[model samples]
Target: MNSLKLPDIAAQKLLHVTPLDWVGMCAIALPIQLEGRHVAAMADAGVNLVDGKSRGIHMSRLYLALEQLEHQALTPLAIHQLLADFLASHEGLSTAAHLRLSFEHLLKRPALVSPLAGWKSYQVSVDARLENEMFHVELSVRVPYSSTCPCSAALARQLIQRQFEADFSGEVLNRESVLAWLGSSQGIVATPHSQRSQASVQLRLRNNLDTVPVTELIDAVEASLGTAVQTAVKRADEQAFALANGQNLMFCEDAARRIHQALRELDIATAFTLRVEHAESLHAHDAVASSQWQW
Candidate 1:
């Protein structure tokens, strides 16, 4: 009888292994700092199979690499290098690498009147791919705004005018009094529908650059809509918000076009996909419109 010693898997170098079509980890939870703010990010990483003949990848190595890069700010350049490092670590096992990172981006916005508003959270995702030694990056963001019904505003005005003429049939028509009445509660009795809406934007960067300020895009969208929905409110802020809703009354089509025009004016027209979803208050289902430019 003879005793045999087994080789250590952790210390021994992996050899003669076939390439994998895909290998790596997914849903890896880690803390990441974006724009000098620390946030939690769920990252997914994988690489294309090498030769279709391999047992499995060193999953622990993938985890460690991600942990090492977790605190580093994720810019376009950093992402490219990270992907390259991930592939190189597994050597011969994969050629192309893919990584997806999703997190909640907190944005601090000022109220229409109130001071020192808290931060608002937006859902954001970043996707990157490395193929043939070229890197590609895409950033996506979800923003919430307010949409008012245009038809409702117009119809209310018409009804108020008719009621005014009927109520003052026997009295002498004084322009000043009539105008005051019209501006009063009785003059504009219209049912206005307000919907909480969301806009999702995805931008593909040229030369694998991901430094495009996502917050700026979100701000532009909120500005284009004229107002963002408020989470916390006071009396003054509420009144200001009401004024905004009344002034910026829009249809679903108007919302979509506004966003499209905003993106176009920014000169990043050819590098993005835009999706606007209005969760309607007047209807049970949502109204959605999407468009993209070719580049």
Candidate 2:
């Protein structure tokens, strides 16, 4: 039996009509390579057409085009080019295109000794848009750290001191005796709660460039706060972590201020957003603060 031939849709378009304002898919998960590192990323691609009288769009074509981008480098420059190509493929249907990709960026870091280390993951997002022959890209990251409650620490110190005095009444207090008393339950009436904290920074790039170093950003954040959460730790590392936390006791406001100051020192533009959230262990609610560059 002979198969009947069908007419091509691209060639049979006889009706002239306005295109759609926005068309495409979202949350497209795929593997991507960045800086020679393979990572799983999700991409949201869409186009805005001059909508007037079109029944629908060729969604499969968009997905096929994105499939080509898979396994390829996803730098800022490459993303700009990809969006341009996507818009070109749509031809008269759209004059603008937008794409958003998000992924978990993993970095291997050493703990505070014990010869053991592991990877720490962060949430990264990249957004790009093309309009009027121009492209814009924005990069964002969420970094986690540790924040100690300064208020709680001060109160705990007072309570412990008071309890120590009461427990050692009528006994000659010496440095060793005081130390022993403090180590017992009678000395530490209360201990402050320092919770795990996270901060998000979103920066709008001036040009299509991948100059922003992810490692540098992570280092700056960890250094500015003087303490970071550990992925792998031993008994020695735990003790070292406690010491570090004691030295870097900070409030939520202090955490935000530290990040804000660090970002200002960077070469990035004065316009950016910094948000910090501290999940309080003492209370059911979290402490959050935000600071944005005015320029």
Candidate 3:
């Protein structure tokens, strides 16, 4: 076997002498430790090519640096160090480093009124950047909830009231008779329309935070909506969920406002943007609303 020097084309000079904004790889499959759980994740790693005279950046260096994420828990400090390593590897060729990690975070959710519980998956992403000695992290999550149309609920109540008046117009109203009638399907003529909805929240985290508040943020959003979808439900839990939907009727706009207000009160993020999407069962199209604060 003969040892030959490999060609260093990336180090060669470029005739165009043009600098690139971002140069690296995307959708790199990897495993990361987050919140004490080992998560299967995909990463997008890149850096801004500041040196115009160079032909291209060393892509292999960025890929190698991402290995650090596998060993340590994902945090602001861990991401900060990763970006530092990216710039260090590229040295003069690059100045700014950017990394985006996408994964499904599994969380155990309990039934509304039952002891049963099951695992739910939430789509989560973390975007990090370090430029000009400044660092910022953005956390994004997608949550699914149930949204009942308020207008539909009001109309259904109106129809039910009219039916009740017609049924007991000339009869003496008694507790047992009314209870039996109310339990009958014919008594409740109409029901409100509800659809599965999703809330997507993007938060720009405070620089001083030590850890990412993913679970806390999710709890706040779910609490505000009050109709989060359930798993492994019993009869009692289903009935409770139905009652919750009836009590917490909302439109897309209402859902967005609720999430916005909840995020505003939280201290985790300096800025945030939220979007609520209702997959309308009444129509073929989906209803959507978006809101933002300091962003």
lDDT of each residue in 30-126, candidate 3, tens digit only: 9998888889999999999989999898889999999998998888889999999999999999999999999998999999888899999999999
Q: List runs of model 1 lying over 4 Å from the truth.
A: 1-21, 174-180, 183-185, 208-212, 267-270
lDDT comparison, 2 vs 3, better candidate:
3
TM-score for each model: 0.86, 0.86, 0.97
> Of the candidates shown, which would achieve the greatest TM-score relative to the real structure?
3
Query: How do the residues 92-168 of candidate 2 rate in per-residue lDDT, one tens digit apiece?
Result: 67788888888888889898978999999988988889988888777789999888898899999999878766787
Looking at model 1, which ten-residue stretch has the lowest summed lDDT? 10-19
- Give the per-residue lDDT digits (tens) of candidate 1, residues 158-199: 887788877787999889988898778777666677889888
lDDT for each of the candidates? 0.79, 0.80, 0.94
Better of 1 and 2 by lDDT: 2
Estimate the overall C-alpha local distance difference test score of candidate 2: 0.80
Error of 1 at 225 (Å): 1.4
Clashes of 1: 7
Among all candidates shown, the one with the greatest lDDT? 3
Angstrom error at residue 198, model 1:
0.8
Displacement of the residue 186 alpha carbon in candidate 2, Å: 2.5
Query: By TM-score, is 2 or 3 better?
Result: 3
The superposed Cα distance between candidate 1 and the true structure at residue 293, in angstroms, equals: 1.1
